[model samples]
Target: MSSSDIFIGEIIGTAVLILLGGGVVAAVVLKRSKAQNAGWLAITFGWGFAVLTAVYMTGSLSGAHLNPAVTLGIAIKDGEWGNVPVYFAGQLLGAMIGAALVWVAYYGQFHAHLTDREIVGDPADKAIEGPHDTKNTAGPVLGVFSTGPEIRNVWQNLATEILGTLVLVLAVLTQGLNDSGKGLGVVGGLMVAFVVVSVGLSLGGPTGYAINPARDLGPRIVHALLPLPNKGGSDWGYAWIPVVGPLIGGALAAGIYNIAFA
Candidate 1:
């Protein structure tokens, strides 16, 4: 694919991925949305369908490598790094746009959730600050945009992300094996969606299963920039784990694929 094609496809596909994926979170978490309190199963399935839609829409253009981790894994497997930056750029841009769109789509819900603290408690009030006490300061509603560890153990959190992303990239790497032992058709895309859903169900608890760097970071940037009430802290301290872990995981998966499969 041409650079333009790759860039456009990644941007569009990833944007759609985040829009629908994040939309589900906002719906489930926000105060008055119909889907509020829909639970984790809903979220996992929502994300799976988001991936399904995005992949189908952009598969022809850039093979729908909407996630940076997937792009990195593919690049590592192929031993060609030329288009990696382009893929990253496009994915990040798409993530941001998708996050913004989510905000727009749930504008009323966001306002409702933030304005009525009694009805919809502030997330930062429960944010961990000290060993025993929580902080009173307002924090950003970052969960809808990014991932956070349920238990704040650095090593454990990092390990969870590494393992989760490892599963994701590994599945992506070995998506569809034809007679030639390469290539993923439509079946592969659908399989990837299920793998994502499986990873979420099995591994999402640790750090919300941020298997893709762009999936987490792009929306994070938007959360920081957007003008939302009581948006709270972006939790930059915990941000690195999602980014670093997924990159490491992708590399590890690629390395494993090259060693065992290729």
Candidate 2:
């Protein structure tokens, strides 16, 4: 694909991916939504379908490497770094755009969810502590857009993401993926979607399975910048785990693929 095709395709595909994926979370978590508290199965399937749809839409153009980890893995596998920056830029931009759209789509629910007096707290005044084993936070709702560790154990959380992403990138590699190994074909897309759902169900409880760097970073960035009412801290302290863990996992997967699977 041409640079323009890759950039535009990734931007559009990734935006659609987050819009649907995050939309499901908002439906399940925000107040009074029909799907509220619908539980993890719903989220896993929602994200699976989101990946399938986005890949189908952009598989030909930019290969729909919507996740930065996937982009990195493919680059490492192929030893072509020239296109990496364009792909990353598009994915990040798309994620932010998708998150903003979700805010618009769930505007009423966001307001209702935040306005509830029980969870309302001044973001400027709170101590802004991390997510301990305490149910003490009320607002940010960034979990809908990104990932967060349930237990807040740094090493454990990072390892979990690395393992989960290893499975993901390895699955993509072992399948003889296309688009410079950045995307999957129709069958491959559906299979990878199932891999994502599998990761969420099996490994998600600890840290919410942020196997994709852009999937977390872009939305977290949006959470910080957007004007969500009384939204709590953005939890920047735990942000690096998602981005770094996935990158490490991708590189490791590439190395393994080259060493054994190739």
Error at 245, model 2, angstroms: 0.4
Residue-level lDDT tens digits of model 1 in 1-262:
7889989999999999999999999889887799989999999999999998998898877778888888888888887888889899999999999999999999998888777857334444555232343432333257889988778999998988888888888887887422332223488889989998999999998778988899999998998899987666677778898999999998999999999988
Clashes of 2: 1
- The residue pairs in collision within model 1 are 139-232, 139-233, 140-231, 140-232, 140-233
TM-score of each: 0.92, 0.93
**Where does model 1 exceed 4 Å of error?**
119-124, 128-140, 176-184
Which 10 consecutive residues of model 1 have the lowest summed lDDT?
128-137
Model 1 score (lDDT)? 0.83
